[model samples]
Target: MERKIKIFMIDDDPDDREFFQIALDMTGIRYTLKTAESAVEALNIFPEFLELPDYIFLDLNMPLISGIQFLQIFRESADLNKVPIIIFSTSSYHKDIEDTKALGASHFLSKTSDIDRLSEVVVSILKGNDLPFILT
Candidate 1:
């Protein structure tokens, strides 16, 4: 049997987290989704992961330890650096996109309120058709 894709997402908003879960559930791809409300929480639980995530979706704005800061720390870690990190945020500012790309983010996906759109993007990433950057 094919192994389930392990996906980790860090976002402070509970509603946004729920939206992501719904999007993933809509996809045909088999996946296991784990989430942390903040970067600090994710870091605290990182060592306990039996299997590291195949992809990590991060939000730009949060109460503490913003996504960019987390990305810097994440890339500094030898073990975590290689994992694909996707900047999933509501911000569409050029600075945000460029900053994340420079920091080694695999892709920058805009957070859309449309569930169908979000699901489609999730499917693309899982299917390996992820473009350089995606805005939805």
Candidate 2:
């Protein structure tokens, strides 16, 4: 049996986190999801997890320690350096996209409200299917 894919999402908004969970459920893929409401919270808790997630979705905007800051920290951690991290954000700013890529983000995707599209993208990512991204 194939092991379920593990995904971690760090976002501040409760509504956004709910929407993302709902979208993941709609994808019909076997996945285990762990969420952190803030980047600081994630940093504190991630080290406790025995198995690192296969992928990490980070919100660009957050209260303390923004996604970029978290990315920098994550990069420094030997255990997390190789995990694929996707910058999931509402901002489509060119600078944000470029910065995320330069900082070692595997992909940059604008947060979508459409559940179907979100599900599609999640499924594609799990299956190692390529989805077009601005920076990579």
Candidate 3:
């Protein structure tokens, strides 16, 4: 039997979260999605969710701690390093993408216009499919 894909989304916006859910739903991919509105919330849940996620979609711009900061913290935690992290952000800055890749991000995707693109990207990542970015 195929293992179900587990996903964790660290994004502050409710609309974006909803968009992701809809995107995933349209894909028909079996997954368990957990959402955290802030880095603190994500960190708080990390202990219990250790190595549970197959993929993590994080937003770059957030309150308090940014995605890069969160990635730094997550990387320092040995248990969290095993899960693949993808920066799903609106900013397409080369510096940000390169920085996250250097920090060990699996991929960096700029936020797309709709759920279809998001779903496509997520499906590709889950299938170990590679796509082009600033660093890929």
The most accurate candidate by lDDT is 1
* True lDDT of residue 7, candidate 2: 92
Candidate 3, poorest ten consecutive residues by summed lDDT: 127-136
lDDT of 1 by residue, 8-110 (tens): 9999999999999999999977889899999999889899999789999999898779999999989998889889999999899899899998899999998
What's the ranking of the predictions by TM-score, best on top? 1, 2, 3
The list of candidate 3 runs beyond 4 A from truth reads 133-136
| Candidate that would win on TM-score | 1
Model 1 earns a TM-score of: 0.95
lDDT tens readout by residue for model 2, 1-136: 7788999999999998999899899988888989999999999898689999999999999987999999998998777898999898998888888888888988887788788888888778778876666522
**Poorly placed runs, candidate 2 (over 4 Å):** none
Which stretches in model 1 have alpha-carbon errors above 4 Å?
none
How high is the CA lDDT of each candidate model? 0.90, 0.87, 0.85
1-136 per-residue lDDT for model 3 (tens digits): 6677999999999999999899888887888899999888888898786557989999989999999999999999777788899898888887898899999898887777666778887788888876664422
Pairs clashing within candidate 3: none
When summed lDDT is taken over every stretch of 10 residues in candidate 2, the lowest stretch is 127-136
TM-score, per-candidate, Cα-based: 0.95, 0.94, 0.91
